[model samples]
Target: MYSKFIINKDSFLGLAMNDIDKSSGNSLTTKYKNIVDSVLKEKFENNKYIDGSKIQSEWFPQVKCDIFLSHSHKDVKKAKQFAGWLKNKFGLEVFIDYNIWGNINDLLQNIDDTYCYDKLKGTYSYKKRNFTTSHVHMMLINALADMMDRTECLMFFETPNSIDLKKMTHSTESLTESPWIYNELFLSKILQNIQRRKKNELVKSQESVRLYADLNENFNPKYNVDISHLIDLSNDDLKNWLFHYKDNKHQNKPHSLDVLYNLKNINLK
Candidate 1:
């Protein structure tokens, strides 16, 4: 169970940023390299049926993450900056899927070249390609679901790249071209809602303060997304949450999320 926070462009950009350098790009690239290496190793290591359990374990290792950041592929830079801010101020470890998932195409290409490519045709077999894609996508979806289940919070960076504002004759709606973003948003809304686990009950040892799109090609399909269920989070709420966390001393150790949940929603009517 996790809480979803919707932070629009304005609210996100307004937050006071720490002096985090642009080194996130290098680190993100290196992290992605490691994942690609691991994937290649798993494929070449031994000849055994790659079962669901092995795929889950090999493809998605248990990373310590307090917030699962959901956003467009284009917003990776902004997401990294935001992640740095969260870490600097709150000691939160964020798992940005872009660090790995953004390079999914490369992974797919490697796999296809090895197994799905037809040498004579100089192209991949349509059916074989589909089979490989479905398996990889299924693994990705399952990993995402498992990560969301383990994390305490999810923050979606709302931006033009991630969502399109559609105005009909009588109503307005938010639509996303990327099925991945749509899936993340849909899961965030429906995933089990539970309170943050206490420190003693947590499997991972608490480090510190507990916590915590893109465009298109030709055949893009738009998904109608509803973000009303997500709690609206603003810059003011972030500042206030910091204060609330600093002041709370009644409990042995307060959950950082409790302070956020207790705050009034300024965006809700």
Candidate 2:
């Protein structure tokens, strides 16, 4: 769920990233625009998140699940079918991203001959309603917050296995990988509060990262950070930082030097 990137404004390649265990940082979906890659695509194909069919999984805890699927319109149909299956089988509520947003010609890009508006409409012809800009963004942020606030990442295992793994594996160490069916998680109820509080904190960190990025561009600050340290931060602190970073507008909040001093004195651990 966490990723550290050294982007050169071109592609995901060319970066020496750190692991979460050694660094104090948060998860990575790469960026708003570039969210996919061959490595990630391969992970999805391999279904690494799912336990083998024979492996007994504990009941999915936290009753009253309301799945919120956030994705480009290109992914709406898949999300809807997935949502419908879960709802019918388990009676769990599902909110596919399409139902919220409306007229997404702007939000989703990179489509021309391979895809078009009329074709996209046909794709969703069976479904009703689309997502609006405000609705989609707000819901996505809300859903992500919910997942992070909870103990588990609202998981679902979709890809059904052709055979049971327990029978195939004679030893504990050689079990096959099973893919997790679900995607995205709902977040905190006090999201508005957390959002505002974090907005004020992130400007500083964003400035730091941007500065680091710029330095990389001009070759200046000689950046160096271990991902393990960032990952080692408690979920709470790291999430707080994430929410702050997300609300980039709040970067201008004026925290007095004394306030920072007081914060430094407080035991974060």
Candidate 3:
């Protein structure tokens, strides 16, 4: 039995069998290899390049979620309240770190606290194998990447501290130097661009192709200015963007209550 299989444009079914064959007996490997080869040859002989756009469309034909709430660890309470409001009012599925990480945050907090204390006490030694810095960092990156992958729409919960830090910073470091919130924003923008590209490719028209090309010319994955401007918006304006009502005729009216009422009435499964 094949333990893992991943089909990509470059490798196809051969790569999957090769990967499994590395750890399997010759006879067992031969059995699965022949099966996979035969299946691929029979079913997918004409399909050379994997249709990434088609696969993406079939998997997420519509918006899988209403929002992905990205916020600082310090603002967990407020974020939770906002998430609860969105869910109760709009029946929207909001993805927050707490929902995904659960008790892992507590564990990581303890580990981080211990690490800091040890460093301050001059007892932190790299020779010790107790949750090294690299391990913890890798765990965080992997978890955040997974969560971000599942998010259909991303909303950053900006606070005073986040705004100040973002404004004060001016480096391109990916590690301890850059704030995690900023990294999350960068990653989200990159993911958004990728999804946009996939969706655009699915249009299958010369006009769409030209439009996509033009869009790419202006697409900056860094999104520094855009994010800063968004952070500077008032609560109502921010809410408008989140609810996608910026161009509505009632844009001048107060948005909070009205938006909530509208969402509450819209029946969403």
Candidate 4:
């Protein structure tokens, strides 16, 4: 019953129509559908096709960052400084919530005001303000989710204001002042696990192919000639190859924390 959209490289154009599960009524799917519809209306007005195929568009949910820095509102200044350092030191784009939401303070203030006024007796305007605030929060959450998916990795800034060291040491789940940061951390971990699972599956498939090639039906000299090179490869060499293959497949990506630490120490060229 859990509905989700699985987008692959092949069928990008049919994204909107492909996953229309009416019974689930998932808001995330609806948001994606709306975005795709808007893009199609603006970009492909003439219904243009390239090489008898639908052209892939990459404008719906814009993601131009290699890393997403999830930090508390109190750490905006530090986040900005770190983002600048990353950009100059490694030529990497960093996405910070502060940049997206110009003034978090003001936004939070408005939400507080909406909540306070909503509790007033028979306030007609309270309903409208509450709806507006809810809509804005939903949009922000959806945007963050999309950015997490697109970014290579998510680096969480664990500051004193955000996390309580005492609680962290004693309890399994440490409470944070900023709930959004915790949400981002959970989503990022899930994404990483999913990616790792996919890579493992790909490795298993490759191993299966190698095994099949080794056990050939026809042992004739002509048939065995081509697979002779494969036969000579040792188990260690095959493992090394698979390791390299996975690295190559992922384009030698660095861990988020590792990249952050390297950026902090290295001098900008």
Candidate 5:
């Protein structure tokens, strides 16, 4: 099962993790890009009907992670800093979408230029681009959901960039301008909270679930987000968790996050 945490603005500020993070990020991004590129090339090698559904599994394969950081595109730098801080302080692997899937735009552009372009008119076909984008976005949404399901914790970096203060008149109601953020938050609220399986336990694979049937090329709908269920953690709460972690640093590094769960008495499994 996943535990959701909302990190308020200015909760923590520190230098990002050093070259280690940079190097690892570069390696992972390059590897992912290569894999995606190869998969696309292999699919197009023949003119036979291409099954986009089958390729979704090959694109953006899931990776083991400790925390999933969901934030606005504008807050990417802050998310990176927070991720680095988490890595340095707790040895946690933070999954920031851009870091791993930054080449999404490149992939879209490539598809549009190759299949959606009208060479005679020197322009891209709107309908063709729409079809390509829908498929790419669907694949990304599925991959993201899988990652969220696998991670132990999901943290949303809440700030003005991600949350619309004007619409938040009541404690229960929240709004966001981002469709991606809306989808992520919506999934967090509904996705089943499965208990973390032990190392030796055999995992069960379930059928893929698609919840965004209304998504489209012009996906600009306003979202009334429900974040009341997410546990609110301020700077002090993070500091308290950090203090507890340091006090018993000798515990297993991988399961160090259990300290925060125990502190909040939340069943994260």
Candidate 6:
């Protein structure tokens, strides 16, 4: 189950929540180096809601994807409700983990305020450089990232089940954060973002660059909608740039048959 809390504190008795946000941001800014420590591995233990799926129909015919929803059990009910919505909306078959979200009666049984507050005060692990709270958080984020990359699984926003969605809907208060989906499509999110990417990354070959450059020169409208504007990049030039290791092959790079197009057109110069 997944949920998110978007706290937009309006003028409650004339004092606004923005004041607190600014103060906290300023405090963090004063000690900016922590950004590296904090940002290095985003310790977000929230569920991820993905609006898109890389799971093509051919991948699974008999089984709908098995999604591993990881989050605090306090967030389970809302996740189930949302899962219901998802099932109704896309006719998607889903499986909710029992550990994170049990029945409502179980929720009532486990609603200890003291337990909630004390959850973070657990033991530290020198190996992981984490205490209980941070360790759990890091684990969740890593799991979420891995799931998002899967061709089938999708993680969704996670929040406590204590949140009242029906009341929230009726009140006309839009969730500012509103619990959006997170994807690693952007370069920063995956390789550089995670503690991964550099070693096994596919490098852009100079041949690919030359190919793009050459294609740009020989591009014609019959081959495309707007030939000049569309295929303006030469594949050959792109390939040359991409071929990292210099060799005898590029010694006498032939001038393109179609006169060298103005680099200024594509702003390449």
- Per candidate, the number of residue pairs that clash is 2, 35, 0, 0, 2, 40
Q: List where candidate 2 sits over 4 angstroms from the true fold.
A: 1-65, 103-269
lDDT of 5 by residue, 1-269 (tens): 35888988767644335666555554544554465556655544442335566654534444556788899889876666677667777787777766435566776777777888899999988888778777767666766676676676789988998888756455686888877788788778766666444433323334344434234677766778888878987777788878888888564553667878888888654
| Model 1 agreement with the true structure over 85-117: per-residue lDDT tens digits | 776666666777675576667766776777788
List where candidate 4 sits over 4 angstroms from the true fold: 1-62, 103-124, 192-269
Model 5 residue 79 CA deviation in Å: 0.7
With candidate 2 superimposed using the best TM-score fit, by how many Å does residue 22's alpha carbon deviate from the native? 45
Worst 10 residues of 4 by lDDT: 203-212
Query: Taking the tens digit of each residue's C-alpha lDDT, what string does model 6 give over 1-33?
Result: 111112111211222224344444334223322
Each prediction's Cα lDDT score?
0.66, 0.27, 0.40, 0.41, 0.68, 0.27
**CA lDDT of 246 in candidate 4?**
37
Model 5: ten consecutive residues of lowest lDDT: 199-208
Off by over 4 Å in 5: 13-62, 166-168, 197-220, 249-254
Model 1 CA deviation exceeding 4 Å by range: 21-53, 56-61, 166-173, 199-216, 246-253, 264-269
**TM-score, cand. 5 vs. native:** 0.78
Per-candidate alpha-carbon RMSD to the true structure: 7.0, 21.9, 20.6, 23.0, 4.3, 25.1
User: Model 1: which residue pairs collide?
Assistant: 72-213, 73-213
Question: Which has the higher lDDT value, candidate number 2 or candidate number 4?
Answer: 4
TM-score for all models, in order of appearance: 0.78, 0.22, 0.42, 0.44, 0.78, 0.23
* Best candidate (score: lDDT): 5
Full-model lDDT, candidate 4? 0.41
Q: Worst 10-residue stretch by lDDT in candidate 2?
A: 203-212
Error of 3 at 245 (Å): 9.9
